[model samples]
Target: MGDAATPLADTRRWLERAVIGLNLCPFAKSVHVKGQVHYALSEAQDAQEVLEDFTRELEALVALPAPERDTTLLVIPRGMEDFLGFNDLVARAERIVRKRRLEGVIQVASFHPRFVFAGEAEDDVTNYSNRAPYPTLHLLREESMDRAVAAFPDAAAIYEVNMETLRRLGLEGWTALDVGPHA
Candidate 1:
């Protein structure tokens, strides 16, 4: 197994440079600042293994108080590297959450080095917002998420704003961030 430090470093950089620096997720900065995000590495090389890791993480998250750990970014640095395969794992992870009877309490957001939006070109700059150096599953507490969304003004417009933010950055600028697939 690899040192947890390496993955944590990479994940932290991605959160700062891509997610925070790019303003991809507005709520991210606050949670990050409060040290509420848990960065965990999953040494899984297959879909089932990844699912197992997801189950473990979910249980841990729900077992603790929300203030202790508001969210978790389960970093899968190996396996399911392909966007489609990573997406499939995400589906299975969601089902596992539901089967575990933790559906509304927690939810998942997906990130991949090759994440692509439907109908968007493979090289589209906007998709870079969701791209990370590895396949990552963002485990969120639904209650906290709902509260954050409610408190944030004009939450519904976040998507449109993010799209425009990427366009302004352009592919060249995104490449400069050095946290994309190739990085």
Candidate 2:
């Protein structure tokens, strides 16, 4: 929203400063450093168009080798401003993966500016773990995820660690990151 490059720039900052800096996802650093992550900007103005964009990104990701493109962040700068609507889009995305019979090969993860855990309060800092500057669909390869999980000694503990990290950081600390659109 800030500019033509705002979405991607802010996303990269969020990934580097929050995701990697906080060690939220232990596996992200490697692919990021190796430049295997793809950043796709969607010009869709509606859910239907967004889904179309999602399908294209999914196909593109699977078409390339893991070493070439391990993952993709389909950034939606228009439409999908509502979290609930974004959730619906995510469901549709999941169905797309299943329909293509790529359910086990690829996965769709959602991240939004207003991401909130089911039971958590909207203002909870922990929700920031999945929040992004704009609505985003994180397409990840199952094989890469499996390899990363296997390489990590305690992959299960990563979630707990992220929770503690965010709790300690608090909203104030999150705002300090300046990765969000408002920030």
The lDDT for every candidate, in the order shown, is 0.87, 0.93
lDDT by residue (tens digit), candidate 2, 46-108: 999999999999999999999999999999988999999999999999999999999889989
Question: Can you tell me which runs of candidate 1 are displaced by over 4 Å?
Answer: 1-4, 181-183
Q: TM-scores of all models? A: 0.94, 0.97
- Please give the TM-score that candidate 1 achieves against the real structure: 0.94
Clashing pairs in 1: none
Model 2 CA deviation exceeding 4 Å by range: none
Q: Which lDDT tens digits does candidate 1 get at residues 1-183?
A: 356567667788889998998778888998899898999888889999888888899999999898889999998888777899888899999998899898999999998889999999999988887887788999999999898899989889988999999999999888788774332
Query: Which candidate achieves the best TM-score against the true structure?
Result: 2
> In candidate 1, what residue range of length 10 has the lowest lDDT sum?
174-183
